[model samples]
Target: MSQKSAPRPPKTSPDATRRSEKSRRAIYAAALELVGEVGYAKTTIEGIAARAGVGKQTIYRWWSAKADVLLEAFLDLGEQAAEQAAGPGAEYGIPDTGDLAADLKAVLRATVDELLDPRFEVPSRALAAEGVVNEELGREFVAKLLDPSLQLYVRRLRSAQDAGQVRPEVDPRIALELFVSPLAQRWLQHTGPISYAYTDTLVDYALYGLAPR
Candidate 1:
């Protein structure tokens, strides 16, 4: 049996894994850069492959369309941002320090920083603009990227409601919009300056209301 044992299958080396990871990152970077530079309408699999320095077949092997590549690229960008914001191996979610107001402010402030980051700002704006005009892409963008983040706020707000910090009658999802929407509008529309101070005030207003106590 020892002499007759079938040849063992070759195992993938660490170098192979590293090379694959490197190629994947290059692809993501190429996709974001191209979209930011030329808008989504003009970005193509062939173009992305060229920019990424990979063969067209490599892209086709991983993704069926350019849309899938761009969406995954955005998701990767978000994940990297989250890791940078929270630290390595950190789980993505709103923090619950039992102080709902403080937690909201902290998360929003991080969002403010992210929005202002050049690496994130340009590509995100480009994609968001495209989503506005493209119906199917818009739905997918909301479902995959936007809604997951929104759900985190919903869960945090629901916890606040349970603890009597937020009113029981309030809807957590809609209540999140009170503060979230204003910041989003300001950033997306360039209607106003975005800052930590601005987001903090928004949280105060949403939690305590504008009228005097």
Candidate 2:
């Protein structure tokens, strides 16, 4: 006589994957909103769990603490913005359209829109101000979020130099910063208002050399 075998459990499908993504987005949104409402020093893991409508265990299962969750949330926000700006699978890199001026302006224009969006701006300023005094977190923020995007600009600038769009003598690292850092400082420090005209001028000044040309 043959014995009946136990049935196998059903596997998760695309719908499950999508649901999980939705849950993750909710958790990130809750974390950002909470942090913005109450400074990071008071933002607690338990608070995030409550705000996210998940059990503490659920948050613990995914993140060690509020800091880890907030750090990754910001990183995910950047990737989402990049995907939206560049389109699906287009990469987060600066566009090498052969026209340096046009490409820089295009990227910077997207940046302007992102900066103006309250969802991005409020949380970012809270984090940035904290980073100004919190050295370790500041460095981590730079390494994880800022540096990667900056590197893409550097690589594109290097390629532009090879193609004769940029002068070969220009240091791609420093050269990329000419446009990037100005906008960063303005946004972070509120040194000036951001606009298309400002970033367009940055591109022109960076490419042409501000001294004489």
Candidate 3:
């Protein structure tokens, strides 16, 4: 017979756990607000801790660097946004409704709404502006935040291809840019207004050819 396994650690009390979660959320809020108010280069762990009303050591105990903390904070923000949009416990991913156009439009519309939200827009714009000048930081944050969302599109497109909606010859990665890049440009440049109807049109134009098909 095998030896008994080591005993499991005792669970944290509900009150203790609640306090920990509250502190963690406060940190995230403080980080987002600070980064938005002052660009990423200027934002610091000390400032975040002060804004969060916690000691510097409190933040250090959880995250090794400001970058790590910011990344997690953004990720938490995304999950919170997703939960608000798509009920609780909803995993952030594209909907695979089998109707390619409808599925694409649905996600894009949600994205348009997100881009318009000031809480997400301000800090993200700050980070994006900084990223344009700071290539290394840009790449790091893009890999952590943006690429995961892009990958969701890639997965959804691959599913469409498997279902025979998209041509097997077409590259899903490039195909997605047709709709995604346009919306991105508009948001970043203030070139055009963003709306559900606008995104719906993009999905239609992307899936169905621009020239008469």
Please state every model's RMSD to the true fold in angstroms: 5.7, 6.5, 3.3
- Candidate 2, clashing residue pairs? none
Alpha-carbon deviation at 112 in model 1, angstroms: 0.4
Best by TM-score: 1
Tell me the spans in candidate 1 whose CA falls farther than 4 Å from its real position: 1-11
Comparing 1 and 2 on TM-score, the stronger one: 1
Poorest 10 consecutive residues by lDDT, candidate 3: 1-10
Q: How big is the RMSD of model 2?
A: 6.5
lDDT of 2 by residue, 46-74 (tens): 88879888778878877887778999899
Which segments of candidate 3 are over 4 A away from where they belong? Answer: 1-12
Q: In candidate 3, how many Å is residue 150 off?
A: 1.1
Ordered by lDDT, highest first, the candidates read: 1, 3, 2
lDDT of each: 0.93, 0.86, 0.92
Worst 10 residues of 1 by lDDT: 1-10
Candidate 3 local lDDT, 1-213, one digit each (tens): 978698664599999888888999999999999999998989999999999999999899889999899899999999999999999998889998789999999999999989999999998998898889999889999999999999999999999989999999998889999999999999998999999999999999999888987
